[model samples]
Target: MSELKQTFNSSLGKKLIMALTGLFLCVFLIVHLGGNLLLFKHDNGYSFNMYANFLTHFPPIEVIAYILYLCIIVHAIYAYILTTNNRHARPVDYAVHTKSPVSFSSKNMGLLGSILLVFIVIHMGDFWYKYKFTHSVGYKEYRTNLLTNQTTVTDFTPQTADFEHSQSFDGDTEIIRVKDLHSRIVASFSIWWYVLIYVISMVALSFHLVHGFQSAFHTFGWVHRKYKPIYEFIGTWLFAVIIPLGFAAMPIVYFIQSLNK
Candidate 1:
């Protein structure tokens, strides 16, 4: 137990934790982005609302959600500790500045991470926390005719104050009622300032992932000469470009649509 504690207390151990948590978060991003893509469906948010319902209500997914939250906290705490230690070791900058081999993203990770942290707090508070704990979000009732595959949406009010989601059948029509999280999302994305902040956070995410993704592989000794190119390619394109672009597009597209209204 003492040895385990010592290992985790060491710098190398901290890096290992960061790598594992970082990679977990990378995987989470892909899953999250895929779910968010449902927003593009022109089904009046029926698909996206169902997706959100499953994520929040499914037992296994809820468990994974908690783990994901823990990973974020652990990753951030270790990053802060490591960055502070590195800075304290140097104490002061050298009189003669020289270009370093480290990448720009690598050097500015602390700043990038700080920006992302603030974004996360705002995002979770605005969406996740409210959805889970508060009655601020209204409800949506989707009545679908089984034969015609047609769905009609209406503003829903639960029969009771403590009501959750429900699905039932009235003859051939399926009635589904869930919290209108999609409506909340639409309203938030319609705000210019909110969209601007979301875009800026995505930019920071791109820079943060550009370095962190490859760095995780290096820390794990998974970057063999033959696989180095593959790692670099995935890190640069998948994590650094596609993921951020995909997330940023959500708010940008929504905001643009709002302008047309």
Candidate 2:
């Protein structure tokens, strides 16, 4: 048991754990992005809220969320350990300037990761914590009249509202419903500073993903010299699209909704 513990505490083991958990978090990010994209498809206001409601009711999914939380903690701890170890290993800072073929992101992953960690804290506090621990005032019970394709907010609980009267709309058949989801998200980012923070955090996330994605694969020994190009391409793509689109979309969506109003 002591030997096992020691092995787990080794640098290689720590890196491996970080790689696995980082990959897990990446998968989580993808799923989260997919779900958030549903917000854009306001077929009726209920589509997104209904999905959100469903998520609240899903026991299996809740379990997965808990596991994800654990993975996040483990990843964070491993990251700190790695950072401290690296710092200790390099007691002297190199004063000379050197340029390598590796991307700038690859060299500054620790800084990027720190920024991402701060973003995660704010993100959890703003959305996840509120959703889980507190009731949202923006949620209104609605009933959707399927025959007339009309939605009206009724007197029932938001979670219990039927298909009809459940949707909200901004225009005629445009389905620009001002939902609780929208309001909460919009309200959070409405502050200019929050928006700025979100943008900077997204930039950090982009850089972090730029390096972390392929680094994880390399840590796992899944790639070789021939596959390096493919790995790099996919890593860059993930950074180029996933990070910016996922985080940036929130502000942009809110801004568009504001302009429409």
Q: Report the C-alpha lDDT of model 2 over 114-175, residue by residue, as the tens digit.
A: 88889889988888777666665256455555557766653334454322223354444433
Q: Which segments of model 2 are wrong by more than 4 Å?
A: 99-101, 154-179
How well does candidate 1 match the true structure in TM-score terms?
0.97
Model 1 lDDT tens row, 1-261: 999999989988989999999999999999999999999998888888888888988999999999999999999999999998999999878899789887889999899999999999999999999989998988999999999999999999998876778999999999999888889989999999999999999999999999999999999888789999998999999999999999999999999989998
In model 1, what are the clashing residue pairs, if there are any? none
Question: How much is the lDDT of residue 88 in candidate 2?
Answer: 95
Backbone clashes under 3 angstroms, per model: 0, 13
- Superposed on all Cα atoms, the candidates' RMSDs to the truth, in angstroms, are 1.1, 5.0
When summed lDDT is taken over every stretch of 10 residues in candidate 1, the lowest stretch is 157-166
Global local distance difference test of model 1 = 0.93
